[model samples]
Target: MKSNFITKITLCGLLLNGIYSHAQQTTLEVNTSKTITKIQPTMYGIFFEDINFAADGGLYAEMVKNRSFEFAMPFMGWSQPNSNTHSLNANSGIATPVRTSQNSNNPDFCRILINDDKGYHIINEGFRGMGIKKDAKYNLSLKAANHNNAIKKIILQLIDKDKKVLGETVITPSSTDWKDYSSQIIATATEAKAQLKITFEGTGTIDLDMISLFPEETWNNRKNGLRKDIVQLLYDLKPGFLRFPGGCIVEGRTLENRYQWKKTVGAVENRETMINRWNLEFKNRQVPDYFQSFGLGFFEYFQLSEDVGAEPLPILSCGMACQYNSGELVPINELDPYVQDALDLIEFANGAETTEWGKLRANMGHPKPFNLKYIGVGNEQWGPEYIERYKVFAAAIKSKYPNMIIVSGSGPSPDGAFFDYGMQELKKLNADIVDEHYYKNPEWFKENATRYDNYDRKGPKIFAGEYAAHPKGVEDGLKENNWLSALSESAFMTGLERNADVVHLTSYAPLMAHVDAFQWAPDMIWFDNLNSFGTANYYVQKLFSNNKGTDVLAITKDGKPLTGQNELYATAAKDVVKKELILKLVNTSGKAQDVTINLSENNVNAKGKLIILTNQNLEEYNTIAEPTKIIPTERDYKMSGKKSVLNLPAYSFTILKLKMK
Candidate 1:
């Protein structure tokens, strides 16, 4: 009898344990009637920097690398190839670089002396070779002065790798004075690695400057505009704001090398070219040929923002160079010019046509104001020097434009000695918005979902600027934009949305990269000479930005936020204009979870839409060959009265949209 009783007790215990485990279901209670805060239109945006060849060789449609012969090495992109003989002395001609005193901004030009015209040709190796299409027209323009009219004609040809001409155009030099000549070449065959070959037809001397080539097709078909395909990806994001100029490029290695907005405006030819700060930034990935042509200047950035319907957020230098490099500082007394630049920029952006800077804007083809609102003082600056410079800028800007919103920096990290110090000082000054940046492992992102839960509600708002998850175990020099990084980023973004009032704006860093000439890894978008694609992280950002509702709604489990409870994170919002409720849930676990979301009010339609982004392998990522390896899939979902049962997939970010009854 005793043995029988023991067996019954053990069996009963097992039965009860199974029942209890099965009954513990994850329940989320959402308060639909109670609105937490209004989500800012600038909540989800994009941050653009010139790192990784993002500007000259990537976005700016100009194919000629050193069009004006202004690089430190004048013939950096040009090569003189001898067709008849292998000996250098047997070549048909020699080109000499000359710096003229007439033009200070663009003084360098190529003076070619053709000896016998035995196929004297110079080939320009374009930005990793120009991307050409069949039957497409390319506009070729150059400034030439035929010395003694010795060079009768300039023959231009687009040639493939085997030296076969794909397109041809001829221009006759009729004048001895500097004059503009233009012609169009139609490519007969498509080629990805084509070079521009210029052959002289006479045996005399000629000078050439501003030898530029652009695709007839561009963003909006403007003369010398941005690449159409790249711009389309940005336009599709529908970002709230577009930050311009740079990450570290704004703060050069030295103060003199810093990006000066004044030089980047005005005519394309007159704009001065400067050495890109990223030319030698990384020892492992040194791009010696990198240089800034300023073809995609401040005006083009503002124009792009307008075209994409995003608010223009321009970050300027704060009289200090990049601390990681030279750490050069302009003394307090010498800071007047920097302050004046800020004042003048506001005038250039918002002032009428009669103002000094405003007149220049009108002359650049934009008569109306850009309607600029937000301006950042610096990019990842720190310490007492930064605070000192920021104070002067804030006082001066407010004195002139009181309503303009000024974004202040909180150093180079999300949390550290410099970040803490900068945050404390900026808070004392009552800053408007404080920018914070972070690049950490995926686990760090998943753990920091509640970072701003205890933030001071009354202090300055937060701009979660420049963030990316660097997955662990990746080699030191290489980082992958894989599914794990994207999933973890989604988990952190839930917290960003939950505290909508405190976190006003956020954007991912290092927006673009080139396949063959990149200096950084894990960029949001990757492109080459011909094709471009968004990464998995980019799709996550798009999901949030597209489904970001107007007002925040409280979502909780057991009377608290569902942050990392059972590896789940969630946030809810309601769109007043669309009359829809959006619930975003992220599951970072390896097992599927059954969740029941209970609505406080019975005001949601039974039918809803669900979008899920998931991948079975965390290391799976998108490449140029497999662009859509991990993308979101949408489907219709059914609800039961005031409650909905959602089977959240493992390692997935899901968005549910329900219409208000």
Candidate 2:
């Protein structure tokens, strides 16, 4: 029955993608005897802010982006603005539908209403005065009313049955264009039904547009904001940190083009600017065109870390420009202001009351410093420009925030002298860490696991910023692996574990890419708005990251090759706080293997609890058409201990946590 069921499920499209039944694999004797796996706490991360899920704008934004928010724009008598993430601007070519005349009633957030259909409104904003209801304010224009003159101001008021003020509006004189006059309303009392009255108080007809409202509480953190549903999935992985914004988004066309810190402040629509990074056109769903007004900004990144019990490792832009797809490296002299931006950025993150940018931090509601510990200078710099700019930024920041750890991002080539040269440069600049990325073949991974053995721990530490094993891809030049990739990844992790103190932190980057909406391939977590599922690489990360311990424990296990193919990659550590021994084991063999575990030296031995992720076939994948096909499962292992042998299924990953009394 089970075989028939799998046959039916696998038949549906398994043959379509060129996947065969699980690949025939072989295993060889692997060892825990001589290998000393270091146990270092890793700051495992996903590109949560904008890389994986676009959950900004609450249900509306994520829905619209996902093409799920299906409201007819010109819904008969009902009307609403374009409501795209970006503001409706001519230069931006962004548009929305709205009602603004006597026959047209604006439902606050629905649209801006102009007196009986005769003008326009533009959203004008700054930091302090933009609040949803409490601090929100707006304007109206009648410029299109033929003989109507430009109004100096407009007194907007909302009244209930007894005539109590429920909302208020005001206009400004800066009218080169039809500008927006807006403010949040703090009704003396609550009233569901209210009437809006625009007291022109000036020589002109009145016009109004869309007005948006949000409780002050909901708008607090915008960028790194994860929907509860998405957060729940992420929380399950138990990651230690998050990499915000994105690798390419950090370096914009111009300084102003760069993410503006000031635009993402406060508790209202006015204070935020929406600049999202993903554009889903399949369903007319567009995101990244608008920044959620960045309602959730940098300050929120810190808060999110606290919320998820993770640490914050913020990176600064190096002066060197980024070629999103061109893959060209800019020369050094061309990158200057960008370097300074890096310096001042740190001032904003960790400076005190005495500094200018720090005062902005204080004004943003976090008076005390964010205490940002890890500050990466540049991201994936491929040219000499990145190297030089990194030095300048490193000097300035280290001079100011001496205690901060400066991380360096090296390009993909291991043979590239840049890493060696970059490492040598760090010694002079007193760099705290070096970022090494790996996007390679399973065999290369097997060869590269010990790549850091020659690395000097006495020197700056290291971080595996972006890495994955794929079937021969362009970026990593990784060759293909049939069933052995999972085990190869597990093998690489063994080295990371054995060298934890020196490894300091590690994260698998470009963590996710929506399959059809992908800019990059073979992401750690892949999904669309409707559904999401992690990849095999993600499982490897989850297995290793979730079972981390505060200190390394000496462990020993002996086993022969479970199969003729490369097999059995494993790591072990003792959890200091829980008094438990956790072992991460992976079997690349296509068949089950019996393994003997000896834990007599660690003292109190108890039955082991296992959380496993196994697929009947190795080629199983998640797609937009069917998203839940391949997900990890958790099961309890029946036995353990010295001379005790147990069976491990093939092409699978297992994380075993054994408790000690």
Please report, in order, the local distance difference test score of every candidate based on alpha carbons: 0.90, 0.51
Instruction: Name the runs in model 2 displaced over 4 angstroms.
Output: 1-38, 48-226, 253-256, 260-293, 323-340, 352-355, 427-430, 472-488, 513-516, 526-533, 554-566, 600-602, 623-629, 637-641
Q: Say what the RMSD of model 1 is.
A: 8.6
Specify the highest-lDDT model's number.
1
Candidate 1, pairs of clashing residues: none
| Candidate 1 lDDT, 307-403, residue by residue in tens | 9889999999999999999999999999999989889988888889999999988989999999999999989999999999999999999999999
State every prediction's TM-score relative to the real structure.
Answer: 0.95, 0.66
Please report, as a residue range, the 10-residue window in candidate 2 with the lowest summed lDDT. Answer: 1-10
Looking at model 1, which ten-residue stretch has the lowest summed lDDT?
1-10
How many residue-pair clashes does candidate 1 contain? 0
Writing each residue's lDDT as its tens digit, candidate 2 over 571-604 gives: 5667768877676667666666655566544454
Residue 20 displacement in candidate 1 (angstroms): 20
